[model samples]
Target: MERLFGLDMQLIADTLLTAISVFVLFTLASYLFFDTVRDVLKKRQDRIKSDLDTASKEKSDALCYKAEYESKLRDADKEVEEILSAARKKALQNESKIIDEAKEEAARIIARANGEIELEKKRARDEMKKEMIQIATLMAGKVVAASIDEKAQNLLIEETLNEMGDETWLS
Candidate 1:
């Protein structure tokens, strides 16, 4: 029953008892809920780790698909180039063939025209020769009818035949 500050021994004992009771209550609450809170935290960490793993796998899949599409695009470009090259080669060959045919046809036409020209020239020479022969015969008849003596006429005809040359009427 020693009082240091005018406080009663009963009041001090009641305060001490209340403090001890509150400490006990706190210890019991910690004991009961500590495992439940730890379990909830562990579950949340596992769920976050699983979501991160899924995101990583999806990223890897997307990268693989992108690489595959790029490879296909390159192949398609090569195929298109090959097709264009073949078409160009074929077109060049066709152009050369057409040019060669045109040259051959032109040569044939020129040769035919030359042959026709030669034939026409020969025909003109033959007609001129025939006209010359008819005129010479008419002139000779007129000269003979105008002559009064037969001997003079026969001599003149022989001299004219000699001057005309041997090959003039032979062909």
Candidate 2:
């Protein structure tokens, strides 16, 4: 086994110290590795704690934003309701005003029409009265033209009265 790599016993004896030095270096490297791993573990634990705190703060912020949004929505809803109520009231007022104005205008038109009808009736009565008066005057002149005597006028008046019925003439 010693002569397998063609090394002499003298070389082996010379390399014994080198082998011990190499083993010592290996042991020291192993110790350093463990210490570095311990430090990395501690840093990783701290980083995880910080990340957890940040996540918690973000969650709290999200809850706060949600509450604020809900509050704003409620306020907006109230404002909208108030505005709708006011608009409805205004609309009702306008409708009443329009109805009242229309009623007044219709009443005025009806009154004017009634007045025109009364005026037309009165004018027609006056025209009929004028025509009846002219016919009565002409008939009286023709009857009195033959005899201007009082006895002839009395006889004519008696004959005209005899021809009239009580239903056709008031008197």
Candidate 3:
């Protein structure tokens, strides 16, 4: 029934009542749903933290495995080098032994050849002595059978030397 500043008093009272009803509904909704929303957000945050922790642990384990593999590879390389070095040393020793044996065999062969040459020289000298003795006996028989003057004796000696030949004296 009354009007203030050209607005009805009944309309103002109705707007105030509607605003109070909206505020009461909003408060009730917050009281009922706030705990559920907070719990869901907390659970999501905990799951993300757990996933990050697992990833970090796995990365650390992979790094440790890489280091162990590298160490084993280095040890294998060292063992291979040692085996190659030992093989080279053994090959050198075998070469030296073979060379020494060859030298010893060569020395023995040279010594045997020299001994045979000496034996051949001795046999040649003995044969020459026997030929000379037979020639001297023939010369004595000729001298006793005929009496000769100095000129005839010289002729006989010259003929005996010519019959002996040059090769017999040269040897």
In the order shown, the candidates' Cα RMSDs to the true structure are 6.6, 6.3, 7.3
User: Ranking by lDDT, best first?
Assistant: 3, 2, 1
36-140 per-residue lDDT for model 2 (tens digits): 988999999999999999999999999999999999999999999999999999999999999999999999999999999888877776765565556556656
The reply for model 1, stretches above 4 Å from the true place, is: 1-47, 137-171
What lDDT is reached at residue 26 by model 1?
76
- Candidates in order, TM-scores: namely 0.56, 0.61, 0.49
- Put down candidate 1 lDDT per residue, 39-136, tens digits, no spaces: 89999999999999999999999999999999999999999999999999999999999999999999999999999988776676576566666655
How many steric clashes does model 2 contain? 0
- Candidate 2 colliding pairs: none
By TM-score, highest first, what's the ranking? 2, 1, 3
Report, for all candidates in order, the number of backbone clashes.
0, 0, 0
Pairs that collide in candidate 1 are none
Per-residue lDDT over 1-171 for candidate 3, one digit per residue giving the tens place of the 0 to 100 score: 565556568879888888888888877777778777878889989989999999999999999999998999999999999999999999999999999999998999888989988878778867776777677557756875787765776677677777876667557
Overall local distance difference test of candidate 1: 0.80
